[model samples]
Target: MSNAKSYIQTVALRDVKCYAFHGYYPEEQLTGIYFLVDVEVTFVHTGDTENLNHTVNYEVLNTILLEEMANSQKMLETVVRRILDRVLDTYSFLQTGKVGIRKLSPAMPGEVGHSFVELSYVAPK
Candidate 1:
């Protein structure tokens, strides 16, 4: 049996809406608002079989996001960073990953659409 393998996979969370209090205004916290998160992880396969142990686990990723969502903060940037840090620390299978966070209802004035931010990280080879 060959002991080498290679694969590219992306795990993503789409439109994960949550109520958070993150803004410069007091009303932002009092009223709360909606936000979305998208996460994508890429990694190479090192095992002979397709199993949970051979690749990144999406369940764990979802759980991490859910936990982070519950722990609200003042900045999505900080939140996204924390999420990326946690993912890097928790998963050893990923070679690289990117996270995109969107604020559906920004605190800006009228007619403004959704705003977003993204961060990417690659594991040291």
Candidate 2:
């Protein structure tokens, strides 16, 4: 257990996809868009990170992500910020975390793969 990076656990939800009406263009709201999110939190478990009480629940995070993504927002940055705020606030014990959001199919003239917005946070020392 000594060399296994024993204490720290990285709780993550990867490439969670959802449909939403969020963009800079008007048609984007009417037709909607695809949003992909990835969230990760690194922390030293107080008791056990695998346990329900000691760790952040995936369902709760999914709910938060869906609720935030449902609203018609103008920017991916706003979406990412709100998700991070809610998660970090709810799980105050987390030492550090990151939130990544991508507009999988942004409306554009040229062929654009995706628009990415990411936010990272570390609790004050």
lDDT per residue as tens, model 1, 5-95: 5677766777788777776567776787888888888877565456777766778888887788677677778878888888988876688
**Number of the top-ranking candidate, with TM-score as the measure:** 2
- lDDT per model, in order? 0.78, 0.86
Listed in order, each prediction's TM-score against the native is 0.85, 0.88
lDDT: which candidate is best? 2
Model 2: weakest 10-residue lDDT segment is 1-10
lDDT of 2 at 39: 89
Cα deviation in Å at residue 67, candidate 2? 0.8
